[model samples]
Target: MILIANGNASRIGIHTSIGDFAATKDGKTYGPLNTDGAFYNMKMLMFDTKSRPIGILVMEIPATSATSEADAARQAEALRKEVSEKIPDLEWLFQHS
Candidate 1:
C-alpha cells in the first residue's frame, strides 16, 4: 500500500505491501478484491490472511503538522513505531517518499 501524508512540506509518503486480501475491520469480508472499490469505503483497512501477498495502495491523512525538519523526522518515527506495534511482522521500507 502507498500512504501519503497530508499536511505541510514536512509530510511524507509510505509504500508497503498489502500482504493479502480484503476484509472489513469488523471481520466482514469484501471481494478477493482488486481495484480499490471493495475497500474504498472502509475507515480502517484490514486484509484476509487467505490471500497471497499483494499491494493495495492507501493514503493516510493525519491531523497534525510538523513545523520543522526535526519535527517531521520525529513525527515520522512516531508513525513508524505505531505501525510496527500494530503489525509487528510487516516490513516497511522508508525513504523520502
Candidate 2:
C-alpha cells in the first residue's frame, strides 16, 4: 500500500533540499512547487515519534504551470482537488498498512 503525504521541515529541523517549506496541521512538512511549476515526486526523510529516522516519505508536488495569476490559481485549485480526493484512501493505508 502506498501512503501519500507532503514533505516539509518540522519545527525542530529544516530540509536542506528544497525551499519554501512549511509545517502543516497534519504533522507533515510541505515544499512549494518547483519553479517549473510542475509536480515532482520527492523522497523525504521521516522521523518516528521518538525522532529517529524510520524511513523516507515519498510525496507528490503540485502540478502547476503558473505563468500568470489566473493560471496559477487554476492549477492550485486542481492540485487541491486531486490531493483532497486521494487523501482518504491514502490515510487508510497510512493507518492500516
Candidate 3:
C-alpha cells in the first residue's frame, strides 16, 4: 500500500492495478500517449473509496532511483521535512511511518 497526500487531503491504497501499462486520473485512463516529460512520469496512482482509480499525486522524489538505501532514506527525510512544513497533517504520518 501507499499513501498519497498534500496540504488538503490524503489517500492510501495500492497505487496501481495495471502495473505501468497505464494510469487512471479523474475517472479517466491515461496511456503512454499522454506522456509529458516529468509530469506523467512522476505521478503515483490515486484511487477513490471504492478502490477505483481517481487520479494521481505527482511524487516529489523518485526514491526508487536512489543510489542506495541510505540515500533513499535521506531523500525521504528531506521530503518529509519539506512536506510537513507545508502540510502539518502529514507530520504524524511521517513520524509513525
Candidate 4:
C-alpha cells in the first residue's frame, strides 16, 4: 500500500505479511491488525490456543492513502477480502498467528 506522510513530502509503499492473532467479540478470528497510524483502528479480543475460535480468518491491511481515512479503510478492507479469498493457506496462517 502507498502512504503519504509528512504532508506528502514522504511517500511510503509497504508490502506486509501477517504477523499476529486476534479474535473479534463474536468469536471470529483475524490478524496482524494494522497498528500503522494511517490505518483504521481495529480492535479485537486476543486469546490463547485453547480458546480455538471459529475458523473464519480475516486479515487487515494498512490504510493505503493519506488524504482520506475512509477511503483508506475501504481499500484495506477490500484488500483483506481479496487476500482471504485468494490465498489458500490463509487459514493455516491465521491459526498459527
Candidate that would win on lDDT: 2
Candidate 2 positional error at 27, Å: 22
Candidate numbers sorted by lDDT from highest down: 2, 3, 4, 1
Model 2: residue 32 alpha-carbon error in angstroms? 13
- In order of listing, the candidates' clash counts read 1, 4, 1, 0
**Model 3, range 53-79, lDDT digits (tens) per residue?**
334434433433555434544554454
In model 2, the clashing pairs are: 7-29, 7-30, 8-29, 8-30
lDDT string, candidate 4, 10-61, tens digits = 4333322233232444543333325555454432332224433323323343
TM-score of each: 0.28, 0.31, 0.29, 0.30
lDDT of 2 by residue, 1-92 (tens): 12333353242243433222222324343444556757643333444434444434444544643454444444444555444444443324
Lowest-sum lDDT 10-residue window in model 2: 16-25
Off by over 4 Å in 4: 1-64, 87-91, 94-97
Can you list the residue pairs that collide in candidate 4?
A: none
Ranking by TM-score: 2, 4, 3, 1
Once fitted onto the true fold, the runs of candidate 1 whose alpha carbons sit more than 4 angstroms away are 1-64, 91-97
- Between prediction 2 and prediction 4, the one with superior lDDT is 2
